[model samples]
Target chain A: MTAVQWILENLPQILELTVDHLLLTVPAVLAAFLLALPLGRLAVRLPRLREPLVGGIGLLYAIPSLPLFIVLPLILGTSIREPLNAVAALTLFGLALMVRSAADAFGSVEEDVRLAAVAVGHSAAGRFLTVELPLAGPALLAGLRVVSVSTISLVSVSAVLGITSLGSLFTDGFERGIVASIVAGIVMTAVLALVLDLLLVALGRVLMPWRRPAPRRAGSREPAQVGERGAA
Target chain B: MTSLLEALDWVLTADSWTGPGGLGVRAGEHLLYSLLAVGLSALVALPAGLFIGHTGRGRGIAVVSTGVTRALPTLGVITLVALAAGIGLTAPMVAFIVLAVPSILAGAYSGVEAVDPQIVDAARAQGMSPRQVLLGVEVPLGLRLILGGVRLATLQVVATATLAAYVGAGGLGRPLFLGLRNHDYAMMLGASIVVILLAVVLDALFALGQRLLARRPGTA
Candidate 1:
């Protein structure tokens, strides 16, 4: 049968696979974001710990996913299911990216701004919440966007461990000689990535309303050049 | 020897070619696949990226295309291609090429765009044709950024080429994947070490090359 005919026949299964794919990515990102923020804050305050923590995270990121998955079962016990293992593996990877960005975002908050908050008799906690986080909001959001999309992609690797996600479509399709399954998986992955990226861009705009939206272009146009200068 | 010890002996044996382990054959195949994929992708992406980047009309499309390509999971792309093309080194090669292109293109396009407009105008005023100005001034000036992209693409491809073993395209990943299949912890660890070492070594080499190229007279 033609590719179109095949897609038409398996529309329901394809949709289900797409949903499975989303499930694999979304949860891991949420988990990573929760863990990374505080860890990032701790790393910044300690300063000396930052190097070791960043280095350790980078080392973990360098490790291949497949072997990591194989090894995890030994440490965590064999009873751990595929989805949890996949989530754990992706969480480690995503944390590496998120932690550094989070730290950098927080670090970039102007000292003068923090001093101003302190002059107003704000407590330490109050200053962080009102001054630092607000100023660092855009960068932290950018980092989250990157982490979200990266998590979506990494989840596809989880399929190798027999986790049922959209990646399974590729595995099943390849084994069964079903062309539609492969196409369906690709189209779904691409669409999901696009939608998530747009959502992140919109979120950036909403949170940083004072800052104008830069032209969505291929090369990095400096924020200053895009006429959004000094807003940060 | 115990089964575990025997596997260790096989991996550590210096002469992997005639030894029970498939290490030499796997490493050779892995390198070949990586080089071919990166080379082909660079060839395709450099020109295409330059065109799209220079045209200035399709910046949105170009940006989105690169982001989507980079964001797609490497394993998913490989599995999908392998499904359509059938399994082998070719499948992974095709996948890496797709993966490599967007980064290279982004690099090239951005490098070209980053070239100072004043330089291009100066060249044009000196009676240089548009093509001549692009070839003579823009490309040379943009070399560093374009090369930066190539370095990143090469590193990504080399690291990811380890996945080729999933489809029976032997590489260091062969032991890694097979060890997972058979629950052979030693083999997996051995393979993992080799893969990580190779990635780091290759990354260092590319970084060194970038430094040398950037420092070369008339290039910086």
Candidate 2:
């Protein structure tokens, strides 16, 4: 059968699997955002704490996901093993990106804006909420956009643990010699990634409407500059 | 020397390296796969990134590619690719390439963009063609940033390549994955140590490269 025919044949299974993949990815991102935002704020306030926290997160990020999945079963006693492990592993990696971005967004708030807030007799909390956060909104949203997209892509690996998702379709498709399943999975994944990215860009625009559109042809130098500052 | 030799001996011993089904591959296979992933990633990401950076017309393409590529976890991408292509080294290698491309592209594009506009104007005024301006002016200036991205990509690829062991693609992760499966802490620790060592060494090399690149005249 043609690829199109195969897709049509297994559309329900493909959609179900795609939804399962989103379930795995979406929650991990939300959990990460919840954890990261506060931690990022804390990191900014106590600059000294930033290094150890970021370093720890970086170390966690470096751990191979497959190994982490394998290790999780041992620690968690294999009850709800696969999904739990996937969540935990993805959470750990997501933390690194989320925390980094949160800190960066907060840091990117202009000093002059903060000074202006202070001049108006704004308390520290007031300044952060009104001045810093407003300015940093665009950058933070950009970071979130990045994190969300990344989470979607990484969710496929959860399939290794028998957690059904688009990845499972891909694995099952290839393994079972079901050409339709494979095509369905790849198409579904690519579509999911594209759709999610557009959503993120839209979210960024909504959250930071005051920010100008990103320079169309700006080089990658800004991230490096940000990295240097963050590392320092 | 004795202690180091003993550690080396421990790593090379049959039990430490053997697979469950007696189909265990050599450490060299692991190294080969890692190298292949890194090499392919560099080859694809660097040029594409440079082209995107220079062209300045494909912002949407660049952004979307980086976003999608970065989002997909190394293991997930590899697993999916493996499923489509069949499990083995090739799938993981392709995934690693996909994984590595975004950072490199982002870096290259940014590096080129970061170049002072005046330099380009001067080069143009001096009768340099667009090719000459790119090759002679922009690329040299952007080299450090591009290198920085490559460094980051290399580190990421090496660390993530450990996942390849899951599909029977050999690497240092084999023992770690197997140890996790069998509850073998000694094996896990040994494998983890090797992976950590690889990361540290690669990181150091990149750091050195960054320093050298920074020191080049006119780069700053």
- Tell me how each candidate scores on DockQ against the true complex: 0.31, 0.19
In model 2, which runs have C-alpha deviations exceeding 4 angstroms? A1-12, A48-56, A71-82, A118-123, A194-232, B1-27, B44-48, B51-88, B123-136, B166-168, B176-193
TM-score of each: 0.81, 0.76
TM-score value, chain A, candidate 2: 0.84
Error of 1 at B9 (Å): 6.0
Backbone clash pairs for candidate 1 read none
**Candidate 2: pairs in clash:** A150-B71, A153-B72, A154-B73, A157-B76, A219-B110, A220-B109, A220-B110, A221-B110, B30-B171
lDDT of 1 at A140: 86
Candidate 1 lDDT over A7-96, as tens digits, reads 888889888878887777888787887787777777777899888876667657656566566556555654224677777777887888
User: For model 1, what fraction of the real interface contacts is kept?
Assistant: 0.36
TM-score (0 to 1) for chain A, all models? Answer: 0.86, 0.84
Report the lDDT tens digits of candidate 1 across residue range B10-126.
567776444444677777777888788889998898988777655555678889888768777777677777876778877888889988898898898898788776666677779
lDDT of 2 by residue, B41-82 (tens): 778777777766666757688887786566554654565577
